[model samples]
Target: MALFGLFRRKPHERLGFELYGAAVRAARQPVFFTELAVPDTLDGRFDLIGLQVALLIRRLHRDPDPRGPGIAQAVFDAMFADMDFNLREMGVGDMSIARRVKNMWEAFHGRAQAYEAPLQSGDGAALAEALARNVWRGALPADAAQPRRLAALALATDTSLAAQPLDALLRGEARFPALEEAPHDRDAGA
Candidate 1:
């Protein structure tokens, strides 16, 4: 039982943080959807958003394209601000907020390969498009498209990369209370 402590968490949990962080770093543009788990009941909300951002950003980073780099980067930046605000509104605390955010990032990052693998093989468009519409369309559409379209537009427009180090930045440790020194009356020539 003692040895299990080192291997307790699932593989995804153990390395997801760094993996997600890397995905975030690799992106050349910001993603539009930065907030992960909102106060709602939806599946793949955050993961899909992250993947969409990654794919578009990855392409922009690799090859300098006119349409890909500029706007994509802007969107990614905006996503982060929105994410921070949303998280705060969700009533997250300083101590665990970073961990939660980072964990979610890692989970999405780890899952990115699954989402992206199909794109490489030209078989991912459907799933990709489905994920996109579900995430960005505001209202979840109820159409019988059978094999749904996983649109890449959301990926092309997300801005999650803008606000980073959210956990590190929000942690209470970063803001130690201002230190007060013993009162010394310099004006009185003490």
Candidate 2:
């Protein structure tokens, strides 16, 4: 049984891995660093990926499809698994990795809560403030445009996710709006 288990992954787990990869690809968009000014540091990267995952999870939660909850759990499991791998690669000791992962989970949940209300409300300023506080870690750029741009992207992402069918999302085929198509002004509205 153990050997068979090693060879066969649950379908949801496979889907989760695929979804995580999609989130990573979305987070790596060069526009985030070049135009949005999201820092290219480890935390910065994680935050972006986390945001993508959170948006997916949020959409799943609202979906009435029977598979929605299972897919959501799978995506969450994939995220923590990736966190574990990253921690080990960063040379964190096994004993400390668990604690660090726990902290990261807490942080991720906090961020989700922070962004959820504003995103749902379609309030651009509120979303910008949330992104500024969470993603930028309170070190908002002097120009103010960067956070606004990020907020616009977040709004677009939310809309894009909402447009995807639950079945497609459960199949790990998530899509986000192109950065070039992201809104540029607060008036653009979520």
| Candidate number with greatest TM-score | 2
- Candidate 2 accuracy as lDDT: 0.84
Instruction: Write candidate 1's Cα lDDT for 1-190 as tens digits.
Output: 8898886753223223333344444332222223221213323445444654565444444443354344335434544544565688888887777787676656545555555654444443444444445444434332322112233322222222222233331221111111011111221111
Give per-residue CA lDDT, model 2, range 13-57, as digits (tens). Answer: 988888878888998999889887788998899899998999888
lDDT of 1: 0.39
Error of 1 at 158 (Å): 13
- Model 1 residue 107 lDDT score: 59
Cα TM-score of candidate 1: 0.40
Q: Model 1, residue 187: displacement in angstroms?
A: 82
The candidate that achieves the highest lDDT relative to the unseen native structure:
2
